[model samples]
Target chain A: MKSAVIVFPGSNCDRDAQVALRQITGQEPAMVWHTESDLPKVDLVVLPGGFSYGDYLRCGAMASHSNVMKAVKDHAEQGGLLLGICNGFQILVESHLLPGAMLTNKKLKFISRNVHLKVENRDTPFSKSITGETIRIPIANHDGCYFADDATLDQLEQNGQVVFRYCDETGAVNDNANVNGSLRNIAGICNDRKNVLGMMPHPERAVDTYHGGTDGAELFKSMVEALA
Target chain B: MKARVHITLKNGVLDPQGKAVHNALKSLGFEGVDDVRQGKYIELQLEDSLPEDQAEEKVKQMCEKLLANTVIENFDIEIA
Candidate 1:
């Protein structure tokens, strides 16, 4: 399946994501610059991780207004699959493609570490492979905390839109599940119909055993298989 | 014309930066500081005297599009 990864000024993870996609899909993904104002025809669009605009005015505030984001928003509305990881997630939150907002880590410190994530749903195109089971991916970032109003949080949970829950090595959820102390320990979420996904963790960074594990490889492979 | 956009986190939203500032203020021996909510000060110089309605609309669009994330922060505009 053809995929495209959006590149903004400060996007450091675009290449990492592209490499992961190439390894899994056996094809080089298109690299779309943020200023292009359009997305190439593809099965998936990825907003890779990075400190866009140097994270100057808040994580994604500046990058969200780029010319290409308008097109990205339009593509998502037309049922195109979109994945926003780390700062990409921040862009999605800022663009209103995903609900909730990202806040600085509760400790106000930058956190970089491998995190365990329990897959909550396997029905969507993004998670259809691996039998919809739990997987562990390294989450490395600051400003990864997620927040939303009580009503919004409740609606997300009630609708089964919460896609992944943080977990410990033992596969348990608790404060450890509360990455960055996000309320409800939400690590990743999807839109109402489950097309767009925004999460703080860097799955692309964990796609190889050299990096730690190959669990994340399936995330890209699943999308290719789904699209095919 | 010059305009300043005040972008602040909405009430009930956790402001880690504000909390740090408040702690620092307390450490500095300042009292009577009920609370501290850190916000942004954006100064924009437009090319022309944008009408009130037009400016308001542009500012709002700016906030929604860039200045603020409606999920966590709210913005107010002032044209000068």
Candidate 2:
């Protein structure tokens, strides 16, 4: 499947995402810069992680309003698959593509570690490859904690939008299993049923044996295979 | 005219930074500090003679569209 990766001023993870996509899909995905309003014809749009716009004025705040985001938003509205990771997740939240907001970690420090994530909703485009299973993905970010009003959180839970929950190695949901201490120990979530996904974990960073293992590879495989 | 927009996390939203500041203030021996809510103050320079209401509306639009996430933040404007 064809894919496109969005690149913003401070997007450090764009290359990693491109490498992962190229490895999985056998073709290099187009790198669309944030300043340009054009988008190549593609099946999926991936918003890779980084300190976009230097993380000034809150993470992803500046990047969400970039010229390309309008196109990305339009593309997403057309039901094309969209996956946002790390700072990309922040951009999604800032752009209102997803509900809720990201806050500083409860401990008020940047955290980088391998985290266990339970696949809460496997029917989604991003998690369909893993069926009711737990996976290990690296999460690294400062403002990763997710915060929403009680009513909104309840609604999210009720709608089954909470796609990934933090879990222990044995796959048991528990507190602190999530690297960022998100409410409900949520590591990732999907919009409505599936099409769009936003998570703090770096699936691309974990997609190769050189990095660690290819456990995160299935996330991309799911998207590509599902699209086909 | 210049306007200052103060953006703060709304009530019921977890404020980890605010909590950290509160802890630091207490450790520094500040007394009677009931709470600490961290926020941002942004100053915007606008054309002179702009109507105050219009300027305020523009600032509000800025906050809602980009400056602040209304899901967890509220902003107020002060013009001078």
Candidate 3:
């Protein structure tokens, strides 16, 4: 499957995402720069993690307005698959492609650790493999708390858009498992159409055994199979 | 013309930075501080030749479009 990864000025995870995509799809994904107005034809578009624009004026705020976002938005509007990880998720929310906004961690600290995540809904393209109840991935970020108004949260829940939630190793969802204090323990969610996904965890960091676990490989494999 | 824009988080949203500042103030022995909320203050110098009202309206558009994220922030514009 063809894929492209957007590279913003301050994106440090672009190469990691490229490597993961290449290993999973057996194709070198196109690296689209932030200033470019066009994107190559591809089956998937990825906005990887990192402090885009140095996280200035709020994380992902400045990068969201770049020329490339216009094309990305248009592509997503046309039902193209889009995956945003970590700061990329912030950019998606900032661009209004996804709902809600990411606020600073409730403890007012930058958290960097591996946490367990439960697959809330596996009906989407991003989580169709492994058949596992939970997966372990690394999450590193300062502003990773997900928040929305009551009505929007209810709508997202009703539509089954809440894709992943913080969970224990035993797959229990509770306050204790919510590492960043995100509302409803939400760690990842898709848009209403289920084509755009935004999540805080760094799946790319967990794609190899050398990284201590390959749980993240399932996500990429799922996408490849779905597109195939 | 100059416009000063104040961007603040909406009420009910948790402000970790503000809470940390509030805790530090208390630790420093400042009494009677009920709460503290931090916000951004931005000053813009307009080179447009529009009228005062028009310029203010333009600035408001700027705030809505980019200065503040309406989803989580509220912005107020003051023209001088």
Best by TM-score: 3
lDDT of 2 by residue, A105-200 (tens): 878889888888888887888888864378888888999998777788898888889988879999988775766778888788888847889999
Residue A131 lDDT (model 2): 46
Candidate 2: segments with Cα more than 4 A from true spot: none
Candidate 1's residue-wise lDDT over B1-80, tens digit each?
77789989999999888999999999999999989999888998875856877987887898886777777878989887
Worst 10 residues of 1 chain A by lDDT: A125-134
TM-score of the A chain in candidate 3? 0.99
The prediction achieving the highest lDDT against the true structure is 3
- Residue A18 shift from truth in candidate 2, angstroms: 0.6
> What TM-score does structure 3 among the candidates reach?
0.98
Native contacts retained per candidate?
0.94, 1.00, 0.62
lDDT string for model 1 (A1-228, tens) is: 888999999899999999998888888899999889878888789999999999988888788888898889888999999999999999888878888888889888888887888788777777878553567888777898899999999999888888888888777888956769888888899999788999898889988889888878877777887888
- Tens-place lDDT per residue, model 3, A15-103, is 99999999989999999999999999988999999999999988999999999999999889998899999999999999999999999
Docking class of 3: medium
TM-score of model 2 vs. true structure: 0.96
DockQ, 0 to 1 scale, candidate 2:
0.85
Regions of model 1 farther than 4 Å from truth = A131-133, B46-58
Which of the predicted structures, 1 or 2, would earn the higher lDDT when compared with the native?
Answer: 2
The per-residue C-alpha lDDT of model 3 at residue A177 equals 95
